[model samples]
Target: MVTKVVVVVVVVVVVVVVEVVVVVVVLVVVVVAVVVVTAAAAGELVKVEVVVVVVVVVVVVVVVVVVVVVVVVVVVVVVVEI
Candidate 1:
């Protein structure tokens, strides 16, 4: 019974992770397109700013995903022990 529950949790986590990754990838592509268009209309300064923002956003998203995964793992371990 416990094993089945753990397996379901693991499967759900995997699905969530995959969805997050897909969303991130799509967001990056869209952001890149917007940046390119804006830079072309604006200038080098704006391009640099946009690139910096994109980097920061990506980094933050990665950190959040890592933290969530860690928390889920800890919860799963606790549940299993119980």
Candidate 2:
């Protein structure tokens, strides 16, 4: 019974992570497309600014995702240990 519970938990975590990854990828693609279109019409300075902003946003998102995954792993480990 404990093994079954752990398997379910692991499966759920995997599904959630996959969904998050898909969403992030879609968001990044959309943002990049928008930035490209805007940059084409805007000046060089604006393009540089947009690029910087995109980089910062992506970095922040990656950090958040990493933290979430770490927390989830810790929780799972604790649960299994119990």
Candidate 3:
């Protein structure tokens, strides 16, 4: 009877240990995956922000050029009329 009890206890302990190891490994993998995915998302956001900034800058430059050209043309026309 004592031998049977000992065998049962050993089996229980072994099973518990295996379960703990499996849980730890799964947690570690989940944490790593989250970190990697977050980093990739952050990188993509930075790229998008950069593209937006470049586009805004280009638009502002074009607007300024158009305004300057209109003013110059008006002044030349007025001088020619005078």
Q: Which ten residues in a row have the lowest lDDT in candidate 3?
A: 43-52
lDDT of 3 by residue, 1-82 (tens): 5665566557556655665565566556655665676588875533545545655665566556556655665565557556
lDDT of 3: 0.59
Off by over 4 Å in 3: 43-82
Q: What is the lDDT of residue 39 in candidate 3?
A: 86
Which parts of model 1 are misplaced by more than 4 Å? 1-20, 23-27, 39-45
All candidates' TM-scores? 0.52, 0.50, 0.51
Per residue, candidate 2 scores C-alpha lDDT tens digits across 25-67 of 8578857776787778766434567667876877777778767
Candidate with maximal TM-score: 1
Candidate 1 per-residue C-alpha lDDT over 1-82 given as tens digits, one digit per residue, 9 for 90 to 100: 7786777678778857886786688578867787778778765445566667877787787678777877786787678667
Candidate 2 TM-score, true structure as reference: 0.50
